[model samples]
Target: MENYPKSINASSLNDWYNSEKEDPVLIDVREHSELEIACFPKEFLHIPISKVTSTYVEELFAGLFEREIVVACHAGIRSYNFCQWSLDNNIVSEIWNLEEGIDGWSRYIDPSIPRY
Candidate 1:
């Protein structure tokens, strides 16, 4: 928990997604209702932060060890908490929290996504 998780802004994330050979795991940790309002254009693993149990972590770990992960929420708060919980629970060593979250994305990457 001492070592902070990496944070990626919408602009940087867009650049990385565009240039990187393999895509990172884009995770939308926002609730179902929140997603109905807006979401990332890219396909993502939509596991709400409330539902991320140990079983879910094990499943993610089993298959996603090789891929980078970026977690997002409405405004970056929940995603940050998720990142810290992941590290504190020893889920993964490298995980990123999307800074400012999808609100940032709506502002920077895709204006089409309506902000709540």
Candidate 2:
């Protein structure tokens, strides 16, 4: 099994995105309605936590196992749970949870990303 990072703070994520040669996929697990309140850059893939079901996982995320995935939610709880489940189910080995979630991102990296 591949050893994956468990979590990443917003500032480090910001720095990684800015300087890293390989672009990591940022997956937002917040609901569609929650997105209207605050949103990250367009580069983030909006895949609500609810949609990560078995069928959806098989259909949409099967090929993402080898990719670097950073999952984010409002306060990090949901994303953390998702990443844990993904790891347990062998969905993705390179998955990481955004420490403190978008709320942290708003406070540490970009204040423009509203906090709810």
What TM-score does each of the candidates earn? 0.93, 0.88
What is the model-wide C-alpha lDDT for candidate 1? 0.88
Give residue 28's error in model 1 in angstroms. Answer: 0.8
The model with the greatest lDDT is: 1
Error of 1 at 87 (Å): 0.8
**Per-residue lDDT for 84 in model 1?**
83
Worst 10 residues of 1 by lDDT: 54-63
In candidate 2, residue 111 scores what lDDT? Answer: 90
Error of 1 at 22 (Å): 1.6
Deviation from native of the Cα of residue 98 in model 2, angstroms: 0.1
lDDT of each: 0.88, 0.82
Candidate 2, 1-116: lDDT as tens digits: 54545889998888888885676788899999999999987488888887788667656676665677889999999998888877777676658899989899999988988889
